[model samples]
Target: MTRSAPVPAPAVREMDIDGEVTLFHEPTQTALVLNETAGDVWRLVDGERTADDIVRLLASSYGAGPDDVRGGVEAALAQLAAHHVVDLPSPG
Candidate 1:
């Protein structure tokens, strides 16, 4: 079965400045600043690409091996989830 892709939370507002991204969740009054790498990951979280697909796209963009970037990509996704900026699939 295909897993659903992660998506940004609807209430989250995103701002991009100088290649960095800032996310604000008004309901929670929480804000998160994402660096260049994390910002890239955030831009790709369109509810269409799986986390693995994201890692592959990033790796290809940087001409790096998928294994080399997977961990960091996963970490970024985890951070987004923790901040309620994105929703990830629950582990089965």
Candidate 2:
């Protein structure tokens, strides 16, 4: 099955930890601790933006490609999701 786009920023929130790192979550608790690159992607996880938007932002911000950023984001997000750190919204 195809993965759905990430929920927009308003529906979620993020916390940046030490270094270029951050955590995404709701008001309850932190969902994940993003490493530098992953943190970059996490910072862009606004409820208003899609995963595609994050890929483009990271690519342009870090001089990378959409595929590269997308891969990293997906991997990190998967790990986070697996750990129950972040919440993927139900498709609208």
Candidate 3:
């Protein structure tokens, strides 16, 4: 079984307030309070980018290695998936 790419769920939307990006889930009536890294990840979830792409993008932005970035992104994605704020692909 292969997992597909992840993207923001339909009920979620992004907003920038005072230079910070925030993601809100309409149905859940919840807003994710994100750090800069999480905000970047939220913005990058456009239904196309893979997890590796996210790690690479953020890694380059922070001038850090991809290992830690990959772990963080994976954790964030898992949390988002648990909240149903992101659409995790079903395994085949």
Candidate 4:
């Protein structure tokens, strides 16, 4: 089964300070601070690219193999989903 691409929540507002990203979830009144790598991941969650695409892109940008950064990228996506900053689509 293939999962749909993740989408940033409509109520989530993002701010980039220097390179780090701060996300504010309006409905939950919650905030999440993302590190550089996580910020990159957040920016790419445009309801288009799948998680695997994100992993491959980041790995290539960092000069590492996809296997090397897959875990961290997946973890970041999970964390964003937990915070309601991004809505992860269910497997179909």
Off by over 4 Å in 4: 1-3
Please provide, for model 3 over 1-92, each residue's C-alpha lDDT reduced to its tens digit, 9 standing for 90 to 100.
55567878898877887888777889989887677777778778877888888889999998999996888898888888877788877766
Please provide, for model 2 over 1-92, each residue's C-alpha lDDT reduced to its tens digit, 9 standing for 90 to 100: 43355543343455555554554556555555557775665556555666677778888888987887788877866665555554565655
Give the range of the ten consecutive residues with the poorest summed lDDT in model 3: 32-41
Using TM-score, rank the candidates from best to worst. Answer: 4, 1, 3, 2
Model 2 alpha-carbon drift over 4 Å, by segment = 1-32, 89-92
Deviation of model 4 at 86, angstroms: 0.5
The numbered model that scores best in TM-score is 4
Give the per-residue lDDT digits (tens) of candidate 4, residues 36-89. 888989988999899999999999999999999999899999999999999998
RMSD of each: 1.7, 4.6, 2.0, 1.8
Local distance difference test scores for all models: 0.90, 0.62, 0.82, 0.91
Report the error of model 3 at residue 69, Å.
1.0
TM-scores, each model vs. reference: 0.91, 0.62, 0.83, 0.92
Candidate 1 displacement at residue 65 in angstroms: 0.5
Which residue window of length 10 is worst by lDDT in model 4? Answer: 12-21
